[model samples]
Target chain A: MKGMTIIVKTITRWVKLFIFLFGIYVTLTGHLSPGGGFAGGVILACSFILLTLAYGKEYALSRLSLKTAKSLDSIGALIFLLTALIGMWVTNVFFDNVLQKLFPGTDFMLYSSGFIPLYNIGICLKVGAPLFVTFIVMAAMRIRINDKGEREIIQEEEEE
Target chain B: MFITEIYLLVLLVFMIIAAIIAVEIKSLISSVISLGAVGVGMSISFLFLAAPDLAIVQIAVEVLLLIFLIRATLGREIVSEKGAVTIPLRLLSIFIVLVILGFGIIAFRNLPEFGKPVFSLVPEAPSNSYIQHGLKETGSANIITAVILDYRGYDTLGEATVLFTSLLGALVILRAKTKKNGTKVINHKETKARGGE
Candidate 1:
């Protein structure tokens, strides 16, 4: 499956970067703003989905393969879990705001929140990668016609 | 403020209409678009309700859901086999709706008016304490963010695990299982010729 059109391709090339940057900004600013981990993650996934729609599945897969997506998904969850455990180890309480020293001086700054922003980043990656992978897999589903004219659902797994 | 209330009322009416269309439309794509419109209306209502956080999240999620819905049904032609709905079933649904509506009105009347919570319920809930102490305790300016990440971090972790499990399950079910050596893989290759296809 090739892309949609040349015009769309050109426009997507210019616009996708900004969309991605906006997603990052939202994820980082979760503690201070309306957009947070889940919201930003959806935006990031949308950028990738937009790429898939404009440039086709092959191109998007080339940029971020299924294996890489699976790894990122697990890594995100692991980081979130590890963050909680680290808090528990330090303060003897799970998910405690352990870093009290980093809290006061930089109030309202990017790194103001002790642990919330880190959690936000983890949630963003966890949500974004899996959402995009889900779309890619759904799009890869095909209806194949055999020599006997029997129709079957042919889901070709992505080769690493 | 009065003008905003009128606008909100109009938006609510449109939302109801869009929801009905979403449920009733024959074409899946049209129904999806109608649902998307309803989502947009809901986001706008959230904004008017002074919840920018909800408004942003609602619109972003709505966009992703629409994209998924459109992609899922894009190439597939709908096979329409109309089944006649029994009169009793339809009547039962209508009866249920009427009963729910009656109860809703009674509940609405019993409730405190907008912006005024019945203090008799919780007796000065932690909402006020959260906003006041959230900054010092959690060091986050956003009250909602503080509450979710610090106060209720365990719940967020549970939600994340749920998402991870859902994706893991979908991948496991969808991917084909392959066998090695001798006979063959358990779920590999439909035909010998098109194994790679």
Candidate 2:
């Protein structure tokens, strides 16, 4: 689990925040831009993966624990479902654009897209957190045998 | 547009070269990098085709793919520098290529000219409507986004559910512990140190 060279670590530290911000921007402005939820979420996950690659799992996990990722994953799914349910309650449609009425904001503006951005945000969280957690869980595997002649899996060490 | 065509032709050439390297290269890391180059070339081609959304998504997906692949190959010895291609395997690949080429030749001759659609025969394509009224109806500047989030929302929901299910499945599989000897005990010190509860 030990990280790469110091050069990579320094470069990652410098660029991780910018990558995160770019992912957020892509997710939020999805309606106005090319990148939507899935693309932006993948970028978001890449940023976290980059940090983990540069600084090792232990360092990155300290910042974002597996517990936090699991909760965020569920929260994202719940929010997405809730948004759709609200659509059903109001319009009797499963996934209708509920904001087609009252405040049909102007096109081309950032705030114009009603539920699109909300859905994008929800999807970004759902996609990104789980993806990162999958990487962490997969990478953390350390198999060993104990005194009772039983094979068990444990987390790998931080150091090389 | 003529110059754009030339650029596209060059990009396509590079993409082919990248694809070949991605397959033929001995070093797994080099192969992955070459595959990413193919992705970049495809993204550029998407840009030339006026599909910025596809270009962005393609690039982001390429990055993620590269990361996961590199991670997967970190300690693996799957790729061998000395591994030689067998004659039968090579013959099979050549046969497949010839078949594809034959199909492409027939298809190209039968199909209409580029930039001309046969969609006029079918019912009004949703894409035409999306381009015409996507922004006005959805208030989203990006028609692709509008279509994905508003018009074809059910498909997107299904896709999201698929991703969610895959993640959930991975979680379950990763967390599954084999109950060995009725008392499975991994290194207690490491478990107490930083294991996810």
Candidate 3:
């Protein structure tokens, strides 16, 4: 039984790794493709969902706690807000082009662009963390009905 | 017909079918799934209309809303299984459908042709510098990104807030709050507190 659980956990972990990598690829190519922060975030959330489904809510939550997810969400939002505010100070408008001084003379290199990548990273974290958190909370709260028609909260089993 | 037009027509038909299913389905879960199909159809239509951002957001919100709604409605099953349509209700639905169809026909006629360049009537338009700078400065090759993140930064901020608010609301609604009595009300408490309590 333990060996079976380990195999299941390994498969789930690999699936999650694939999803995470795919999400990163989508986010990086967002500027050129149909995918963006939102798509990437959803893809990332799917990984968490997959893990939860494979190993149950307790296993998933042990790896990513609600507190950590909430903190990441708050930090992402703060970073996004601060980036816009910094732009306001430099160019007199929120989210203005403040990175022009960093790379002078129409440098169109990928890294040359100012806060777009930063914004993408913030959005990725913002969308991914909350989405996963919601999934975890929902899955944890799910009432399992047994053959005897009893509603059991699975999370409480973890404490036992 | 061109491929784009064909795709649009197919999407339109699918949307109509999904809407019909959403109305006709007796089960709430089936209805919600049908509604999701409708949302996907609409998002495809948005993509056909050259609004990918709206499509992405629409799809995301629809999925999130569907999950949230399903979770909320899980315990409260719809009791009725008759699936009967009353006469007065049917007539009212028909009346509403006719009104909506009439408006839709009129709106369809008013829309511009596909692939035609939108002509600006006003002379003093904002400079395209913002868009150009967005492409150059944002490192994002997608023009939509430039428009969303740079040209209309404040609007994006508002969108982010909406996303945040929806998540917060979902969390508040779905979170398992401990009872005031301090007794953990979930199952399997014996094994859980065996060591400590």
The candidate maximizing DockQ is 2
lDDT of 2 by residue, A106-148 (tens): 7788788788898899899988998899899788755566666
Instruction: Give the deviation of candidate 3 from the true structure as CA RMSD.
Output: 12.1
Q: Which residue pairs clash in candidate 2?
A: none
Deviation in Å, model 2, residue A12 alpha carbon: 1.4
lDDT tens digits by residue: candidate 3, A1-160? 2123777878876778888899987876665666777788789878877877787766677887778888888887887899989888877877875875465333334554567666766777788988998777665555455456654444444331
**CAPRI-style docking class of model 1 based on DockQ:** acceptable
Q: Whose lDDT is higher: candidate 2's or candidate 3's?
A: 2
Q: What is the lDDT of residue A11 in candidate 1?
A: 97
lDDT of 2: 0.83
Residues B1-197 of candidate 3: C-alpha lDDT, one tens digit per residue: 38989999999999999999999989987888899899999998899888898999999999898988777767766555777789998999999999999999999887767764234332343444544465555555676766676677788778788878988997665445644433234543543565522
Residue-pair clashes per candidate, as listed?
1, 0, 4
C-alpha lDDT of candidate 3 relative to the true structure: 0.73
Question: On a 0 to 100 scale, what is the lDDT of residue B127 in model 1?
Answer: 76
Residue B153 in model 1: shift from native, Å?
0.8
